[model samples]
Every structure is written in structure tokens, then in C-alpha cells.
Target: MRIAVAGGTGVVGRHVVAAVERAGHEAVVLSRGRGVDVATGSGLDAALEGVDAVVDTLNVTSLREKVATEFFTTTSRHLVAAGVRAGVGHHVLLSIVGIDRASGYGYYRAKLAQEEVVRAGDLPWSVVRATQFHEFPGQVLGQVPGPVGIMPRMRCRPVAAAEVGTYLAEVAAGPARGQAPEIAGPREEQMADMARRLLRARGRRRWVLPVDFPGAGAAFRGGALLPDGEGPRGSVTFDEWLSASQA
Candidate 1:
């Protein structure tokens, strides 16, 4: 099987590519860095040649609603159309678990729009909704902090991106399920505490103040983003992920 990873150079997408190859499938990396831009449909049709499935982990780091929506909508449309033309058998999309409930957030709104496009596309598709990654603590610390590293009050169940990647590969190899089961971490942790732990692991001493935000912040604090009922849980804990990073 030949699998095309649309954002193969990304944080989780890179691991998805590796997982696909490790599972004995040919992995093709599709990214703007490789002269293929999914958002613009550039080099997409050519890259779709011999592609059995497409795993879309493409992402844009923007808080702006229009920018986010445009990126996702355009990218998904191009990927699906090109996949149909190439006779690709399956289309797998990676999305956040709580996008449906938290559409007020700009990024989640884009993700939801992307989901709609995928569901309405001509190709058979699967949307794999996943919770936050343990690496998110690090990612957030860099983005949401001011003088000292602090995280706003929110609930989070952060899985390992590597685990998310593996799950994506598995879904890509199998027949499309339309909407796959949601994936999450083993346990839930407060965002501020997670940030503190990450800071401690990095040998930094700082106060992580937690602020209560309204709207989207309220949704996160209310646990809207945490996986409900049962979902697949990865084995690596936040501590485990940090230790491995050190090693």
C-alpha cells in the first residue's frame, strides 16, 4: 500500500509517515517544503499518483478565525479532489476531539469546517478525532506565556503525538470507517500543573499562575475537551515523554 501523508513534515505527521513505513507500506511525504502545498492544490495531483490512502495531519498555527478556516477548508478540498482523481481508496483526517463542542474557538471552527468538507467529499474518508498531546505542555509554554511560564486554567488529557501517529497509520491501512473512534490520553491533568511539570523537567524554576478565562476558557475548564466515555489511551505518560526527550 502507498500512503501519502499530507503534512508529513509536521510534529505528528512525521511520526505518521514513520509508522506507515514501519508497517510495510510505502510512505510518501506531501508538503509545501517538498513543493506540494495542499492548501493551494500545488503539486497535489502529481503527488497523488499511486497513493492508496491520504493521512491529513496538515495544520496552521493561527488564532485568526478566517486564516485557520481558509487553510483547513482549502487543504481538505484539494486533498480529497486530488485523491479521487488518483483513485485513492481511503482518506484519513486527524482532528481534535472536542471540535464539535468547542466550535467557538477559531482553530476548532476551522477544524470543524475541514471535517465537513471531508465528509462531503467524493472519496471514502475517516476523521480521527484526538485529544491534546503531552508535548502540548511544551508547545503551550512557548506560546501562551508572558514573563514567567504559566498556563490558563483548563482541563486537558494530553496523549503522546507518537501514539496519535501510530493510530492514524492503522486507520489509513484499514478500510475507511467514515468516522473513527476518538483517541485520548490515559488521564486528565490541569493545564497549569502540566505546564509546571514541564518547566520543572526543564530545570527551570518559575511560578505558573492559572487564570480563569471566559468563553473557550470556560469550555476547557469545564472539561469539554477531555475525552468522554472510553477511548484508546497511549502508554507514555507526560513524565515518560519528558524522560525520553532527555535520553
Candidate 2:
């Protein structure tokens, strides 16, 4: 199979690329870094040429609602249009679980918009919604902090990004199922506690204070963003991810 991975160089996209190649499929990485700008439809046709399926894991590093939505919706539309033109059979997209339930958050709102566009696109598609990755706690700990490093109390079921990537690759190679079952980690965990543990693993003495954030924060705290009981759970624990980060 000749597969194209949009955003193939990104955080999770890289793992998808590797997994596709490992499965003896030809993987073409499509990204701005690879000369294909997904947001504007630049250089996309050439990338989709001779491609059988497209696995879209594209992402933008932004918290603003408009910017995130613009990036995703535009990119998704462009990818679907190009896929239809090139006769791409299956369009595989990686999305966040509970996006419909938590669209108040800017990022989740953008993701939901993107999913909607893909679902209504001309190509046959499969969308896989995965829970937050174990890496998210660490990413948050590094980004959101005061002098004392505070985090908000919330519930999360974090899967390994690599496992999500693997699931996406498997789905990309299989039949289009419209929307696949949501995927998540094996267990649920508290957000602040996970943040503190991440800090401790890094040998940092900063205190992780938990607070309530309005809007998006409240949604997170309300468990509006966690996956439900229908999906396959990944085996890796948060502690395992932490330990590996230390290595």
C-alpha cells in the first residue's frame, strides 16, 4: 500500500510513519517541512499522487480557538479535496475522544470542526478518537506553570502516543469504518497528581498547585474530555511513560 501521512513529522505523526513503513507499506510524509503545506493546498497533489490511503495526523501548536479551527478545517478540506481528485480510497484521521462533548475548549472545538468536515467529505473516511497521551501531563507540566508550578485538578485517561499511532496505522491499512471505537489508556488518573509525578520524575522541586480554570478547565474537571468505556485500552501506564522519559 502506498500511504501518505499528513503531518507525518509531527509528535504522533512520526510514529504513524514508522509503523506504516514497518508494515511493509510505502509511506510518504506530507507536511510543510516536506514541501506540502496542508493549510493552503500547496504541493498536495504531488504528494497524493499514487497514494492509496491518507492518514491525517496534522496538528497546530496554538491555543487560540480561531487559529486552531482555521488551521484544522482548512487543512482537512484541502486534504479531502485532493484525496478525491487523486482517487485515494481511505482517509484516516486521528482525533481526540470526547471532542463533541468538550467542544467548549478551543483545541477540542477545532478538532470537532475538523472531524465534521472529514465526515462530510467526498472520500470514504475513518476517524479514530484517542484519549490524551501520557506525554500530555509532562507537556503541561513544562508549559503551564507559575513560579511554583501549579496544575488544575481534572480526570484523564492517558494513552501512549505511540500506541495511538499504531492504532491509526492499522486503521489506515484496513477498511473504512466511518468512526472507529474510541481508544484510551488502561486506567483513569487525576490530572494534578499526574503533573506532580511528572515534576518529581524530572527531579524538580517545584510545587504543583491545583486550581480551577473556567470554560475549558471546568470541562476538563468535569470529565467531559475523557474517553468512555467502548474503546480498546492501551497497556502503557503513566508511571511507565514517566520512567521512560527519565531514560
Candidate 3:
């Protein structure tokens, strides 16, 4: 089987590619670095030729709803249309678990729009909604830099990016189930605490300010990011992952 990973060089995308190749499938990387621009579908059709499945792990770094929505919707539309023309069998999309409940967040709303675009498309699809990855806190901290790191006060069940990658590969190789089970971490952790721990693990001392923001922050603080469904869960805890990652 041939599997094309849309964000094949990304954090999760790299793991997906490794997992797919380890499973004895050809991994076609669809990225600008590989000459395939999935964001606009410019080089997608030729790249998707003879591809059996496509896993969209594409990511955009924007907190604005319009920007995120446009990126996701455009990439999703192009992928679906190209997959149909290329005769791809399965289309797997990586999404967050609580986008439906946490639409208060701009990025979540954009993700919801992207999911809608996927479902409305003519391709056989599956949506794997996972919780935040263990790297989420670090990502958040990097977005806003200061002498003290700003950490949002939120509860989350964070999984390993590698585990999500493996799950995506398995799903892509199978029949599309449309809204596949959500993947989450084994336990929930506070994002603010996680941020502090991350900084500490790096042997750095920086004050982390935990703020309970309104709207999206409220939803996150209210535990909207916690997975309610009994889905596939990773075995690695945050501390365990942190320990290994830091080592």
C-alpha cells in the first residue's frame, strides 16, 4: 500500500511517515519541501497519482479564526478533490478531540470548519480527533515569548505525537470509518503545570503565568479538552514522556 502524508515533515507527520514506512508501505510526503503544495493543491495531483491513501496532518501556525480556517479549508478541499481524481481509497484527517465543544477558540472553530469541509467532500474519509500532544505546552509558550512564559490555565489529556502518527497510519490503511474513535492520553494534566515542568526539565528558570482566559480559556479551564469517549489511549504519561524526552 502507498500512503501520502500531507504534512509529512511536521511534528506528527514525521512520525506518521516513519510508522507508515515501518508498516511496509510506501510513504509519499506532500509538502512544499517535497515540491507538493497541499495548501493550494498546486502540486498535489501529480504527487497523489497511484497513491492508495492520504493522511492529512497538515498544520498552520495562526491563532486567528480566518487565517486558520482558510488554511485548513483550502488544504482539505484540495486534498479531497485531488484524492478523488487520483483514485485514492482512504482519506484520514487529524483533528483535535474537543473542537466541537470548544469552538470558542479561533483555531478550534477553524478545525471544525475543516472537518465539515472533509465530510462534505466527495472522498471516503475518517476523522481522528486526538487531544493535545505532550509538546502542546512548549508550543503555547513559544507563541508568546517574554521574560516570563505565559501559560494558559487549562486541563487537557495530552498524547504522544508518535502514537497519533501510528494510529493515523493504521486508519489510513483500512476502510474509512468516518469519525473514527478519538485518541487521548491516559490521564489529564494541567497545561500551566505542564508548562512549568517543561521549563524545569530543560534546566531553565522562567516564571509561568497561568491565566484563566475568557471564552476559549474558560472552555479549556472548564475541561473541554478532556476526552469523554472511551477511545484508543496512549500508555505514556506526561512525566514519563518528559523523562524520556529530556534524557
lDDT of each structure? 0.87, 0.87, 0.92
Which residue segments of model 1 deviate by more than 4 Å? 144-146
Prediction 1 TM-score vs. true: 0.95
Best by TM-score: 3
Give Cα distance to truth, residue 3, candidate 3, Å.
Answer: 0.5
Instruction: Give the per-residue lDDT digits (tens) of candidate 3, residues 1-247.
Output: 9999999999999999999999999999998988988877889999999999999999999888899999999999999999999999889999998878888788888999999999999888999999999999999889888768888888999999999999999999999999999999888899989998999999888899998665687788888888887789999999999999998
Angstrom error at residue 85, model 1: 1.1
Best by lDDT: 3
- By the lDDT metric, which is better: model 2 or model 3? 3
Q: Can you write out model 2's per-residue Cα lDDT over 141-230, one digit (the tens) per residue?
A: 667666577666778898998898888989999989898999899888998888878878877887778876545677778897687657
